[model samples]
Target chain A: DVKVTQSSRYLVKRTGEKVFLECVQDMDHENMFWYRQDPGLGLRLIYFSYDVKMKEKGDIPEGYSVSREKKERFSLILESASTNQTSMYLCASSSPPWTSGGNEQFFGPGTRLTVL
Target chain B: SQQGEEDPQALSIQEGENATMNCSYKTSINNLQWYRQNSGRGLVHLILIRSNEREKHSGRLRVTLDTSKKSSSLLITASRAADTASYFCATMTSGSARQLTFGSGTQLTVLP
Candidate 1:
């Protein structure tokens, strides 16, 4: 079975602080993603990495950045956290679409971040 | 922008009854997927229906896709209290890389 693990289950940070959320997958998948879930707005993609050092912005990527220095690890970085960024952050990993024919994604237990 | 939107944002049903949720997308998609999320946890992939296929089933869950209407529906048979969760529909647009656009999701509650 595939396993995706997040760095934290719950986190708290003060305004203007830098925050990092980490995700690691054991399946050696080539694709990884970061998303934020908020009521009414749902899960919105923040950023995604197709391979090491490759990153793409999603619909809402203004205040966030991502790093994928290793195939098994993906990190989401908030340069300066704000209260608006407080939410449940989720990470997912999946095999390349072409190889698996759009395989299902494996998600980690999300990290609920509170920016105060 | 969100490509898919789920209708009947909240649903309440009793055990043994079937629960149905609908999702509609705006653009052509390569495939659609259904995911389930408990209260504050991450999502779990439930099922995926290709655009060329009309209907598919797994266990007690049935999924139907209509390309003409750009919509899909998920039916959970013999629903139980444990089935309560938020269900979301995600779309992988044709020609897109590996990203999926997710919908707002429907919160379903099953009472014993």
Candidate 2:
């Protein structure tokens, strides 16, 4: 089975503090993504990387950034954690864009971040 | 902005009953996918239906797409307590970055 793992399942950070959430996939997929899920807003993409060292901003990229230093691992960074940023962070990976059957994203368990 | 919006934000149903959820999208799509998310967990891809396809089924789950209406529906037959979760419909637009535009989601609660 495809497995995606997160660095932390729960995290608490103080305002103005920098926070990092890590995600790793074992399937050797070439695409990774970060998203934040809120009660009513659903899943809002923060950033995504199609390949190593390449990243693109998503719908809600403000105050969030992502790094894809190596294949199989992607990290999400909160430059400065804020209360409004508190939400469930999800990481997903998929096959390269051009590949057939690549549209389905395999997701990690998720990281629940609390900003105080 | 979200490209899709799920109707009836929340639903409650008894086990063994069928639950249906609808999703409407704002743009042309290459395909539509459905996902299930348990509380505090990441989403799990359930099914994907391409724009050309009208209907598809997997196990007890059935999905239908109406490109003209820019809408789709998910039907879960003989629902179980384990099936209770949030269901989201994501749209994959042609020529886009391969990232899906997700809907707000429908929270389904299947009573045991």
Candidate 3:
């Protein structure tokens, strides 16, 4: 079984603060992703990393940045957290779609961030 | 947007009853996947049906895909209270990007 773990399950931060959310996967997957879930928007991809040091912006990546210094770890960074940034953040990892034969993403439990 | 849209945003049913949810997408897709999420948690992969396939089943879950209609349906038979969760349908398009587009989701509640 694949396991994806996040650094925090819940977090609270003041406005304009810099926040970091960490994720680690044990499956040695090459693809990792960060997403934010809001009430009506569902899950919107923030950023995805295909390899170490290689990152691509998803549909909504303006307010967030990501780091993939190692294969097992991916981190989401908020440059300046705002109240609007409060959301349930999810991290997922999977083998490269072409090689995996199936594009099934395994996700962590998620971190509910509250920016006050 | 290649995002799939789930119909009947919310569903409520009694235990031992059947529950069905439908999803419709806008573009051509290589595969469509279903996921289930409990409250305050990340989603878990449920089933994946490719465009070339018509129907697939896992345990009590049955998934059907119709490329012509650009839609898919998930049926859960003899649902239990533990089946209550938000279900989402995600699409992986035929392009090279390999990004999965997700729908808003359908909240299913099974009463005991």
TM-score of each: 0.98, 0.98, 0.97
Off by over 4 Å in 2: none
Q: Is candidate 1 or candidate 2 better by TM-score?
A: 1
Q: Pick the candidate with the highest DockQ.
A: 1
Which segments of model 1 are wrong by more than 4 Å?
Answer: none
lDDT of 1 by residue, A18-55 (tens): 99999999999999999999999888999999999999
Worst 10 residues of 2 chain A by lDDT: A96-105
lDDT of 3 by residue, A3-109 (tens): 99999999999999999999999999999999999986789999999899999999899989999999999999999999999999999999987675449999999
Q: Write the per-residue lDDT of candidate 3 for residues B1-112, one digit (tens) a residue.
A: 4379999899999999999999999899999999999999989999999889999999999999999999999999999999999999999999844689999999999999
Docking class of 3: medium
Q: Candidate 2: give the clashing pairs.
A: none
Error of 3 at B74 (Å): 0.4
Residue A49 CA error for candidate 1 (Å)? 0.4
The A-chain TM-scores of all the candidates are 0.97, 0.96, 0.96
Is 1 or 2 the stronger prediction by lDDT?
Answer: 1
